[model samples]
Target: MPFVYMLQCADGSYYTGSTIDLERRLSEHQFGQGAVYTRDRRPVALVWHAEFDRIDEAFGWEKRIQGWSRAKKRLLIEGRYAELAGWSARQRACRERDG
Candidate 1:
């Protein structure tokens, strides 16, 4: 099985990734061998994860979440799916306004 996971880094940032073995991957992250982005942010904690039947699905989801805003990601981690779309729309509106 494959899984999409999120880690809350020490600096209050989120890192999203996919792995076949969550435990092994998490251990690697904890040990500073997982990702370059996480290497310096050691001691990351698993904040959220979802299992998938296929590796591609998990990877796709990981990529998608990686592009999300921190607020949207937090919404997901908090299981507040109902608020995601509204936040996403607000984000887009802010971007459009800023541009």
Candidate 2:
């Protein structure tokens, strides 16, 4: 199985990734051997993860989640799916108002 995982870095930033071996990847991140973005933001903790039957699905989800705002991501981390639908409207309105 493959997994899409979200890690909360020590700096309070999030790192999203897909991997076949979640344990090894997480260990690497904690030991400063992961992505450059994560290497500097060491001591990361896995805050969320979803298992998928296909690696492609996991990778695709990882890519999709990486583009989300911190607030949206936090909703996922907190398992607040009910807010996600309304959040899209709010996010779009905010973008339109300020962008």
Candidate 3:
């Protein structure tokens, strides 16, 4: 199965990616052998993950999650889909206020 995963970096930031082997990829990140983004922020924790039958689907989801705002991503990691709409509303308000 293909996997979409999120890691909490050592610096309290988040990273999202996908892989066919979650365990191996995670190991790589922890050991500073993975993506450069995660390499500098080693000792990451696997905060979220989802499995899919197709690699393409997993990759698509990875891209989607990577594009999310931090609040939206946190809602997803916490399994709080219902709260996302409220968060999105707040984001829109903030953006409107800023500009």
lDDT values for all models = 0.94, 0.93, 0.92
Clashes of 1: 0
Compose the digit string of candidate 1's lDDT tens values, residues 1-99. Answer: 999999999999999999999999999999999999999987799999999999999999999998888989999999998878857766789979999
The TM-scores, one per candidate, come to: 0.89, 0.88, 0.87
Q: Which regions in candidate 2 have their CA more than 4 angstroms from the true location?
A: 89-99
lDDT of 3 at 1: 91
Worst 10 residues of 1 by lDDT: 83-92
Candidate 2 matches the true fold with a TM-score of 0.88
Question: How far is 27's C-alpha from truth in model 2 (Å)?
Answer: 0.3
lDDT of 3 at 96: 88
Give lDDT: candidate 2, residue 88. Answer: 66
Q: Per-residue lDDT of 1-99 in model 3, one digit per residue for the tens?
A: 999999999999999999999999999998899999999998899999999999999999999888888989999999997877746656789978999
Q: For candidate 2, lDDT tens digit of each residue in 20-75? A: 99999999999999999999998899999999999999999999899888999999
Q: Model 3 reaches what TM-score against the true structure?
A: 0.87
